[model samples]
Target: MRIDPALRALRSNPDSQRIAQTALETCKSGWRSAEGNASIFAELIRYGRGDELGECPALSSLFADLDRAAALVEDLVSQILPQIAAHPLGQVPFRHQYSGGMAVLQLAAAGDAALSLVMYERSGDTPHSPTICFTDTERHEIALAGSGTMQIVRRNRGRRAPAELSVSSVEMKSGQNLSLCGMFETKRIESVEERLVILRLGRTGAAPEPSLEFRVADGELVHQASGDKRDSCHELMVSLLGRMGRCDAAPVLAEMTRSGSDHLRWQALRECLALDTATGFTALCGIARNPADTLSANAGSLRAQLIEAYPELAAFEKTLCLA
Candidate 1:
């Protein structure tokens, strides 16, 4: 393939290289000293309160300051687009290419709050995503250019509320802003008019509840993921200990089964069972017998399956019954 003479010169010439490098560095420097970014960073640290806090109260303030964040994004884009036009190799730093033909340019992040500019291209003939996912953080989005249609859904509540979700369609026009709670609401881009650019500000801190993914048609829970970094790490450790056959860790796992989220408790119980059946069986039986335990029904079902698979477990079942 033959390369264009100008493009080749831009790639090889020392003068062109210096100009491209200077353009990229200028974008980064301009963003660091942006007017509103320092205040946003200060707010993130103040309201983040470490990861131990369940929810971020800083989200409310971030949503209210959407225009300030928009101004920062506008300033950053003004510095970046010109350089890209001058040289194809010149681009902003911290640009992340994600799935669905979308790109995210992280402008600034501190503590639990992050500001990003997202660019979405119209996916011609691409089918809509069958699933929608939500995390524990809260977010605010401002459309800087182009337009799109968004589908939003939230949990229905009240004494007589039905099991179905309350769904709504939102027109995401240029200059519009939206605030959403991942704990209670989720939004999906249904269609883009052309190319869409948005300024998104969010609290990256995890809430008490885990992230969830659900099927749009039936609202079936397809996946659950822990938002807490420590919980995820603990889960990995538990799996490792179980695979290593560390029966000495059974006591620690036993204690873990009594605390934390329902999912974590169940995970600890499972790893404990794999390492030591006797201890695990006793804990399992205790959970199954407790009507107050959230995992009681699941534990009871597992206990039945175990007894059927191993006749020796029947003796343990009989002993528990007698006790």
Candidate 2:
């Protein structure tokens, strides 16, 4: 799996949007289990319209569940919406409409996906609104225009109780391949050792590269080459060198010159400078003059750059310079 592409797409969106999408997906997938339903419901309701409640049977049963779901949805929406709406990327639309004595709220997405949110309200001396929120994930497409409606009624029982009902209707004519709507925030990168483990376990995916890049970025070449527990990193590197070649690990190659192990240092010396005018030339020069190793590859550009900056290599420039 090429995780980098997905990571790139997610980075294009706000971190909060990603997190909220992740939370919403987790809730839908039943990862939170029954105990988490209430919190999920509250989050769905917070930005949702009071009249949109009828779309979900769970929301309608809020009273039976002590309105726990409603409260959770409300809290989540309240906490997340301000940040999501305030994001500078694009605007998310929320519209409120009233018809036949009922109020409806609809949400529209202006960026990648088309979304609708609904709320319902009943009229009387005291009116109540119920809300529900939803995203279209099954079609793997973007919604162009979607709408939601809610209905509310007043009942004259002995107690004069009020009854509320709402329905959210969505029609998506067009769609885009989007990461699950609620999955933006839940993605995480694993450690280098863990990545090696996964690679060894045959989990061939792009998820490991970023982690490996981090190790190189932090100047942890020894850690990258030598696996934490076993010689796995070494074996992996050797295999990758044979198949993908050393240049493929350019970032890592750049750091190998400073590696603790002599073997790694030599490997870096040979491989890091193999490609003409590669980025790792500076490190290659240090290895060439170490006396323990011979400079087989040409290093003219390396010497030129070094002489211009350090001037001390001027005398030995002829031998070190690539032909």
Candidate 3:
């Protein structure tokens, strides 16, 4: 097979490669300059704190000021686009691609909060996905260009037993803004006309509840994932200890079972029972007997299941009666 002339030329472009490398170094230097727009925004968020802003209100206030936000985005765009053009081979530091035909580029971050640029290209061949997932975070977004419709779904705060939800749709256009509290509400781009660009500020902190995904048709929960990194780490440690057969860690696991998030408590209790049956059974019984505890019903059901699977565990119930 004969080699294509265009391909052969591309393979031997040392002069172009050298020029591209010089352009990339220049772009990097400008981006990291002390007096650059990125540095100003970074310092603004880190004013009263260390490298990270400890309070969410600071970021919230910045995002709420529409005029200031617009100016910041304009300044960032003026710097970012030229950098991209100069160095096409370079990639943004933080870029996240969404399953719904969107991309987010994080421009600056301080602690749990971050400023990001969101972009979606209009595509008729590969349409955007309808599925939506909600995280336990606070978000504020300002549209810089294009137009779309945003669909907001909120769980009714008044209802407890069965999850009740309400839906609302708002027209999104250039210069418009929206704030969403993901603790109870979620937003999705219902439709986009042409291309859409947005400036978004997000703050994700420790939340008591997990992030949730729901089926749009039936409004039923499809999946849930933990939002707390610390709790997840603890659960992982407890499981490791159990798998290692570290009987000495039983006391620590037992203590964890008495408090903390419902998910973590149950996980610790399970590991504790596996490592030290006596301590695990006692904690399980305590939780099951407490009507006020949130996991009482679950603990009771778990105890019954255990006894049915391992009849030897029935002896522990008799011991509980004697005690």
lDDT of 2: 0.36
- Across residues 1-323, which tens digit of lDDT does each residue of candidate 3 receive? 89887546656875665566666555544654535355445554663233333344444444555565566667655766786676555554355666456888776676666778898766565543444567877777888788888788888665363457677898877778888888788887767898788888776764546877766656577777678878889889888998999999998999998888888999999999989999999899899989999999999999999999989888978988799
What are the runs in model 2 whose C-alpha is more than 4 Å off? 1-232, 246-248, 275-277, 290-323
Which regions of candidate 1 are displaced past 4 Å? 1-30, 50-67, 78-95, 158-162, 204-206, 227-229, 289-292, 304-323
Estimate, for each residue in 58-141, the C-alpha lDDT of model 2 and write its tens digit: 533432342343344454466446545544332333455656433334332222222333222323333321222111121111
Write down the TM-score of every candidate. 0.72, 0.19, 0.71
- Candidate with best TM-score: 1
* lDDT (10s digit) by residue, model 1, range 1-323: 99998778876786877788787887777666666555555555655555421344443444445565466666766777777777677655675767776888777676676777888888887786777777777778878778888888785433232225567899887778888887678787778888888878777554456887767777777787888778888899999998999999988888898878787789999999999898888888889989999899999999999988987988987898898
lDDT of 3: 0.73
**Top lDDT: which candidate number?**
1
Return the candidate ranking by TM-score, descending: 1, 3, 2
Higher-scoring candidate on lDDT, 1 or 2: 1
